[model samples]
Target: MPLRLGAFVHRRIIAPGALASATLLLAIPASAASYSPGAPGIGDPYYPAYGNGGYDVSHYDLRLKYQPATDELEGTATLLARTTQDLSRFNLDFVLDVGEVRVNGAEAAFRASGEHELEITPRTPLPKGTAVTVVVRYRAVPSTKQAYGFTGWHRTPDGGIGANEPEAAWWWFPSNDHPLDKATYDVSVAVPDGTQAISNGTLQSTVSRLGWTRYNWRSNKPQATYLATLAVGKFDITTGRTDSGVPVINAYSKDLGDNYGAARASVERTGEIADWLSGYFGKYPYNALGGYVPNTTTGYALETQTRPFYSPRQFANGSNVSVVVHELAHQWYGDLVSVAGWKDIWINEGFARYAQWLWSEHEGEGTAQELADHVYASHPADDAFWTVKPGDPGPDNQFHLAVYDRGALALQALRNEVGDDAFFALLKGWPRKYAYGNASVAAFRAYAEEVSGRPLAAFFDTWLFQPSKPGVSAARGASISTRDPGTKGAPGRPESWKKIAATNGVHEHPER
Candidate 1:
């Protein structure tokens, strides 16, 4: 599922404040640099090409029809994008699967890329703030891994949805793809009678007339486009809450009766983690959270929005709730305050991976130090990790263990050095800072330095840009020598809800 090639770029992302020319630079090792902290890639600008970089997407409406036997979906997407410039050219990111494009009621010329990309040039210049109704007609077959890693519509044999990533939904619709470019969504899906369609928020109602049915789901909160998800098929899902009171859901196939037992422990544990995380990060970022098991083909799960897509066959401990906590934490970091682009994926993978470790710590799976030790052990000892940004991070860097795990460990170390108060405070501050827009590796480095009140350039250079893992003892020795015993033991902890307030210094939508 690797791309034939990556996009060319003027600047590569190295972490916040870590931008570099596209030229190769070998200084440190991040293990899986090909896919980790500082990958090199160009910006995937908002669709409609933001007419002279003037607009950002604020809302969207989706219409779709599904053909189960062939596993295909046909649909039209309408979007409302906000811009400050009067634009003549409009371009959107779409796969080769989509065809036919009309802009503001006029046919537009376009070209295709991959199975999921289309470049359209509009006929007339659209004035900024003049919301254009971009109507796109398209058809798509499910994928193993294509276009933003979305494998749409996993289902149980009974025809119930097991997992869906609205991020993956881009193949089905066109809008601002980043969580930072969040907008309201209204989805209308046509499915057969035996199936139920589930999306981001509450189910409003389903209309079934004329031998056709359309299920409409609406989300009022500011939603990162990727959070949009739809699961269709058959599976029995039980819902409840934990002692701490976060809602819990477990979905399993009909024949997997014994598998149901795992849900008991998983759900409760999820609830506990939910309460604890929300307590620190702020209220649960969304209205609800759920886990859908679509017969585990993959060993891992995604921390999508309220609905986390999972595969049951990957349940190793017979208790798969750790996946639950990992995804739930994403509601705050990834969903609410989204990363700006693919290069900043560590904002997603690193944090989510660390959340898993954090959960293990909370559950007594290990001490925080032990978790860090485990991650450090997993990092590769080669220079490839650092020399390569995402594009150069290495061929296997896309979510590779070395980059995601080891990279996250770097932040964990920073957290420990900064103390829990500063550490969690930074976590809560990040998303809020870049709410609804793109961020760069440079931005993250700056944020960390600001929050830690310490310069991290050298530190980032060592771990984030180096071509290989720094010797553990060397890293530890530096930490010891540079450690400031005078730094407050633990700064005052910020109340979780404190970050609920948006600040003005940084632009949430950088592309805007």
Candidate 2:
């Protein structure tokens, strides 16, 4: 029995108590759309919550004709999805940062209790092995800045960083925000004449109509909704391959973040980093890899599945090359081996930073002093560092030292205590062992010890969990191959890691 609630798109017929807050751009997904196991909860077992059972959204074949006239998103989005668990419900988020929305054939409710949500619930129950179709029709002005109107300097005459995207992807459309819930996607972005539109994965087709442009993209692997992105601007396109021979296409917009040279570096070096990772670790975790560097205001990069979003300014003129390495590392560490919650951010940031270290050492420090200095400076050394344990990288430490410096140091110490062969062997196996899913910090630590054939408890306890950097004990029969200690254990001179250190926020040398 389906209860009919004749609520307008902006207002709900259901009691305000029963209907979640209908925020502008966000709302319900999965559980309410189809038959659900029961009423959904606040968080799911794997992904961010619309509070329901498995909302299997693995494959998408978006079929639509779109036009961006009058600055509105006018089109149809046909979605096909399956669930991991049974008993009926499915849900997802869509930016709907536009004017209107609808689902299937009915007037699906746009129930966003907060920002960036649209809920669609069907009247009947469907059994397992059943797939559902969702079609949305809508229009609105795409925000020039990031989603939700993040303020910035006014646009330059040419519309540079002055008009930047303040926030990340979830602003565009909705799906599960976290990576544990994967969705294979087919996206078609249509823009104005002479403008280019890009999304994740391969470009299947691009057609220009009377007055608008359309580009369709499809992703074969499962992906989180947050990483799903769309870019519409005047862009320069380049197609290339990674070092190990995986093909990729990169899009750079004129005066966007970076220009031709930066795009070239990303196309060239990001693949090389992938090869380095595969050589030390194992196969590239993803089936495909590429990126979209929109004309954006973000200072850092978002490692969105196979395709990451980079700010052109970082790579232009060869400035932030290691960022390419760090973000590419996230393809495996963040996108593929996702952390279960925001708390476990280190699993994403730490490993990526470690990749930068590996690249630094491989390239040669040009001198012993240079290499030693590079590693020491990267340690999160203040008493504050002690407070920001590996598990809890303090409020200030989350994206900063604990995750970046402490995380990198953790790997360096492990490599020192164990050997490079054993250390890298563990990293290579990590993604293969826990591909496209979540794992706790404890699980990772144990895996390292098991693979190394040594007890890493001291290394882990003293660094990963301990509040302070406990004094290093004697080797205790463990073979220690550290770079070098100088001036009574004080951190010595810095050099070699100019590329890596640059990305970590240090622009100067470490005091000896």
Alpha-carbon TM-score of each model against the true structure: 0.72, 0.75
lDDT of 2 by residue, 170-288 (tens): 33344444444556788777666777776777788788877767788877666655556666666677777876778777766676543657566555566667888777657886656
> How does each model score on lDDT?
0.56, 0.57
Put down candidate 1 lDDT per residue, 1-512, tens digits, no spaces: 00112212244457644445323355543222321111111234322221113346667788888766666777888877654344445445455266777877898876764444456556665544567667778776654335444444453454433233324454456654444456778888888775656666655789997766788977767776556776665557677765555555555555555555674456445666777886567666555656666553444466556666655543533766656666777777667766554556667656765676666666655544555554344334553444444212432354544455556667776776677888888877777776545566778889988988988887777666666665656457334222222344312222311111111101111111
Candidate 2 Cα misplacement greater than 4 A, ranges? 1-54, 61-71, 82-91, 95-107, 125-130, 142-169, 256-263, 316-318, 366-382, 394-397, 474-493, 505-512
lDDT computed for candidate 1 = 0.56
Error of 1 at 322 (Å): 1.8
The alpha-carbon deviation from the true structure for residue 444 of candidate 2, after best TM-score superposition, in angstroms, is 1.4
